[model samples]
Target: MNRLSTNIFRRSDALKSKPDTSAKQPFRVRTGFLILILSASISLANAEPQNQKNEILAELNAAATRVETVKASLQVGIPHPTAALVQWTEALVAYRKNPEFLYLKGYQPLVPLYFLLKSDSDAFSLFVPRVYKVFRGKNKIFDTSIDIDIALIPQDIILALKPLRINDTDHTEWKLAKDQTAFELTVKDKEGKILRKIIIDSSEHVRYQVEYNDAGFPYLEIWKDDWRDTGSIFFPYEIKMKRSLPKKNELVLKFKEIRPNEKLEEKLFQDTFPKDAEVVELKESSG
Candidate 1:
């Protein structure tokens, strides 16, 4: 009887020491693992486009902040209803609304024209400086108030990217498209209208841009080439511009020298017309 009790106690101890083979895992373990993997894949895919857009915006902001003012030589070709008048001259083309003046001297009588675009109004005004007897009455012929269609503000590549960086990001939308050879970015408004379309090659810099009108039609196009870096800024030495409305015209501006961020006075941007000269206001439409 004593031997039988000892064998039974040993058997009971052996049963307690055995592993719990009957227990089961949680119900959703496998499913949770699969969902986690899918979420990670989606996050990686979405991050690519966002990264590309941020890179482009950063580049644009860097270019815009490099200069406060610009002075260059511009050759403008003005197309009349009948003939085209081509003029090559030097200009102080301010980038930050400091003041812009075009000095035309290739003609028999020199005419110095100043350009002012009022942000308060939807129009841009042109005025000539009040000339004294030095012009020999030749200044009167050019002393006229000319207003052209305000469809698009005529700007170079550097000035053109200013609004994109400064304005509210919610008002802007960026879309990317790519082909086998090149890539393009279309910047749109809140209403899904294309404001500007930029094209790039392998270098990934802006090579060309087409600006649109309110009706979503291409109004002006700019092409930039021969980029030069002036320590503080990088700008294109050769710029070509073409317009599609009002009067068909083309301008090729070659910068023989570019002066960036020159200190200018506040009085420069104000109207500098002579008080005695008769002011004639002329209005032209974008049509």
Candidate 2:
């Protein structure tokens, strides 16, 4: 009986020892696994500290290239209107509200224009600067109160704009028939009226498309949207503007001369309003 009791006690001790051994093995394995996981997470967290500066600079370089290509192509097709130019001018007269476009076929469309004078029919234009000079008859003349877009403004303005972003690849368009490089942009107003569409010829940025609303602001504009040079210099040479939405009217322009680096007198930038001309500056919208 004593021997039997001793055997029973030893068996109980063996069973308890088995459980402690198993528990210790599992605990050690768990601790090792946790350490490995923590190390991996810490290494991954500190990988790249750059603020995407390299990526942004690369994009800027590409954009500058696109603009440069346009500037170089400005002088290629000049000395009067090409076949495309004639068609563009014809479209303007047939759809133009000003009627002056009818006899001005020889003159290229610089920028769309309309009178905002309170005394006049309350017209407005795109945010583009106005031109006091025009190609009249056989001579380049100054037409006072004449709604025009000066070349200097368009050339300089295109460069000054901060490149907002590359448009989604989807909405982008090209007129391969006229020139493969021309790119067109179209934006709309809250009323669903076509607000703006402009085309820029990539081959020659000088040629561009500046669509005009009935009010004469570009509803769409395009000029040299691609194949830009490494620099940001640009000019609109061949332009086409289509009035889309409520009405359908289209105007195209061909530049006889597009000088990107033209030397301009500082006085040109100032408001040289005539003494008799009634000039009232419109305050910016509070909204």
Candidate 3:
């Protein structure tokens, strides 16, 4: 006989013992009952961790939903590693969700810079008062000349302040830290490429986040601190973003005033530049 048949015959001979007639039950039935119990125990043990992950995800979504609109006055700091002092400027930023609109006005020394985004139409406008120029475009936000402008992307800015709501389409996996003080949540796209990874503390506040580029490289690392309670939701007063490629640069925003869920005026989303201001329509390079 083959090895497989010999093993089966040995198992059959092993169960050929006399049945326990006193208990009024067959041994095989008792053994089957034990196997069923073991299977149920294993299933429950596997379900518990998944249940915890679901609860954590629900809490994150609940917090994100509480933020509808936010308007803040902030101090923008660009740090130079070689220089002794950091370049500081002031800015006013406002954004609203559920269509996604953002308006940023930066007070530069030479002139004020205005950036507006309307996600519904995928349109963006940049106004530079110094040059009396207004550049309007669609799809792309910045030009190739602006190397350190990734931090100024409207979507990234909004994500840094407001946490993204985990949706059904996003593949998410989380694991608790060894010390159980925090958990790391990794969100990936349908193609299994990591979109972003967030670290949340015990209080469910996002401590840090790493955003990946299209080529699956870490492009930006963000650290959030000094959370402020804005009644409706918790807002991070201090946000620092570190760029990894081309040249390492850091941009920090210190929010002086944060107002959440405020009713923003419609005019804020519109372009109110002077008619005489030279309109420069930025076209996408065919290359």
lDDT on C-alpha atoms for all candidate structures? 0.50, 0.33, 0.71
Worst window of 10 by summed lDDT in candidate 1: 133-142
Per-residue lDDT of candidate 1, residues 200-276 (tens digit): 55445566788777777887787877777766777777776776643454666666677667764556546554566
| TM-score of candidate 3 versus the correct structure, residues matched by position | 0.70
Cα distance off (Å), candidate 3, residue 224: 1.3
Clashing pairs in 3: none
For model 2 the local lDDT of residue 43 reads 54
Looking at model 3, which ten-residue stretch has the lowest summed lDDT? 141-150
After superposition, candidate 1 runs with Cα above 4 Å error: 1-51, 73-86, 97-123, 128-182, 284-287
Q: Give the winner by TM-score: 1 or 2.
A: 1
Question: Candidate 2 residues 82-159, lDDT tens each?
Answer: 344332221111111121111111223563332111110222111222443222121111111224322222211222
State the lDDT of candidate 3 residue by residue for 1-287, as single tens digits: 26645655565565556454424334555576568768876665444356567777888899889888889999887787778677777898888886777777778666556433343356666666666777676634332333223335555566677766777789987766544567788899888999999888877788888988777888778999887787878778999887664346678889999998899888886657778989877664454
**What C-alpha RMSD separates each model from the true structure?**
17.8, 21.5, 13.3
The runs of at least 3 residues in candidate 3 whose Cα sits more than 4 Å from the true structure, single-residue gaps closed, are 1-51, 81-84, 108-120, 139-151, 177-180, 245-249, 283-287
Candidate 3 backbone overlaps, count: 0
Estimate the lDDT of model 2: 0.33
Which one wins by lDDT: 2 or 3? 3
